[model samples]
Target: MMKDLQNKTIGVFFGGQNPEHEISIITGEFVIAELRKMGLKVIAVYIDKNGIWYSNKKISELKFFQKDYAKKLENLSSCYLDLTLSRNKLVLHCNKFLSRKKIDIDFVFPTFHGLYGEDGTIQGLTEFFHVPYAGCGVYASSVSIDKGLTKKLLSSLNIPTTDFIISYRHEFTSNDDSLIFKIKRKLTFPVFVKPARAGSSIGITKVKNADELKVALALAFHYDTKIIVENSVENIVDLTCAVLSDGSKIVTSDVQESVFGSSDLFDYSMKYLEDGGAQTGNAESNLIIPANISNKHTEKIKEYSKHIFKEIDASGTIRVDFLLNKKTGELYANEINTLPGTLYHHLWEKTGYQINEVLEKMLLQGYARWRESKEIHKDFKTDVLNNANQLKLQHHSE
Candidate 1:
């Protein structure tokens, strides 16, 4: 039935200049692996940190990520898509000197994460290119990627989220002490400070007192211009809920609880360094089946999740993170990961769908969005372009 994707030259586009660059690579590689498993012909396209694009042979090798990757990558030829011209087709202009070799891409599966990629930039480019892409459109991606914007939109919809002190970089650096006092006065200590636009908890810090506030601010501002510090959720337990869509409808996966080590919060080391389970290294989460929570709680979270999805007009698959106050059992939407890890395939795996199946569904959604977008048109046989004399006279008069 889905024969259109068979050897369709799908572009598995990932990698870029973001703090989440490495993580994006992991996700992109995993998505490509799954796509290949479905027997789909994928043209792996990578956007390097310097903004150079690579494709074909250079993309398949995982070792291109080694310490001297750029030097190694310099040899394997480069490619780029010229959307500056008419983007009605997937023709890629290799290089000016070389004969233009147009890549006949069926669709683009953007597995990019963090700033420049997730913050509506890449999505906007795709829209201009008129290319089919996985996940939300430009509006959803922009609103949902920016934490301040997302919070305002969600709050307007009555979505429950933590009360936060959203601070901008320029203002905070001027008066850190006064700002800290304001936070201390308004909200209690043990707050969570994070860069507004990051994921995987890269620039997130748990500050318990005034002493730790400065350090946390410095760490967070390194990643973003704006920072948000949420009043501590007494007994923070994270609940991650994922939703998959094929544009027409959404199917949710089971809620999973992330249990932390008793000693401290799940720092980067605890989350990723743990090599073996129950060991000091190799980050692993002890996933509790069904979350060991009441059905009522599950239903509340699931309902709220779907509501947020529809309200934002988000499509494709998204993972909405929530933090549950251990005492109150309240679920506060932490943030929305627009392009979540491995598209949150692990969550679906627990729900009976394999990686290949999930990838297939996402591709279908991509193509569906593409087909639907064809209904809109900004083009027309305008008399202005046809009558060059009229346009020239209008410009001169203005």
Candidate 2:
């Protein structure tokens, strides 16, 4: 399968009109490098924060974005996807007159982390073009991005998850007291307030008391319209496991426990800015693989990770987070990241697979899913359109 892909061109899409744009760029470059190592033709498709698409070979290099990168935009060509069903190509428009180039893309590998790109938007675009793409499909992407929706689905399936209450910006604005009352009635203090649709630990606040609740909600609302307030688990240990699938079988990676700082919170700084910043893939030492837990807990986490992946109809690779309560020895599903940072290759690496191997499996699974979708009868013979004139006449009579 890897050999078959070698001859095909894959578009590695990253960066977007998202808060996690910088992180996405890192993941994108990592993917491009690994794909090239496999002898695959790769195109770096970069979407700026303004939502403008650009293409340049230089984008494959991390240094190309540093030191006044905005000025470098002129060096890159503006590009857009030619979503015509028959032609899955990326159209690059150069600065020169009548200068347009089209690059045929056999597959799309999305390294986007949050919002516009990861929350079903980019996936939907590829689906419209009938193009095979990596990561979860529209349904899975949309559900997994919203923390509130994910918890609701998990609860429905009897999957244990932390208790959470959702608050909309409009509701909070209209009746702050009522919303606060509802939150206080349902959840206890020291709750974690988070932007429901945001990631990278951005716009998250660990509210310690009633006095801090309002401030936390405001911060969360600044990032997203909906906010989720989850009860903070006492003596919590943050554990994450990665899951990969080829549309037939599911595999779980070794569970890793994230060591937190004095704040006891895994915020944005802890995730991307701890070590040498986002450039160095964060601090490796902060993540302890084969987490310091019993065999039973590890197996349970692995089981839950696989179950969540399958239940959500997810494809490709994903990272599932769980909050372990050391005091009570209880585990609760925190959230699911359909497109985890750097595809959570670190966890998979510890699980006996290289980054290239993981990417290969994702691309193959995407192709398989696309092929299966094509088999479904989309052009069903129907008389509804044929009776248009009769239907119009009946409507006029009415």
lDDT of 2 at 185: 93
Measured against the true structure, the TM-scores of the candidates, in listed sequence, are: 0.88, 0.94
Q: Using alpha carbons, what is the TM-score of model 2? A: 0.94
**lDDT by residue (tens digit), candidate 1, 131-212:** 7777777787877887777777768878788888788898788998888888888877788898888866789898888999
- Candidate achieving the largest TM-score: 2
Best by lDDT: 2
lDDT of each: 0.76, 0.85
Cα lDDT of model 2 by residue, 1-398, tens digit: 55667687888999999799999998999889888888889989899999888877888898998778889986667876554523453444434357776666778899998999899998998887777888899999999999999999989888899889988999889998888889899999879999999998899998888888888889999999999999999898999988998877789999998887566588788788878443233677777888999899999999988989989999999889999998899999999999888888877888899887788789989888887888888777788877679777889999
Model 1's lDDT to the true fold? 0.76
Worst 10 residues of 1 by lDDT: 276-285
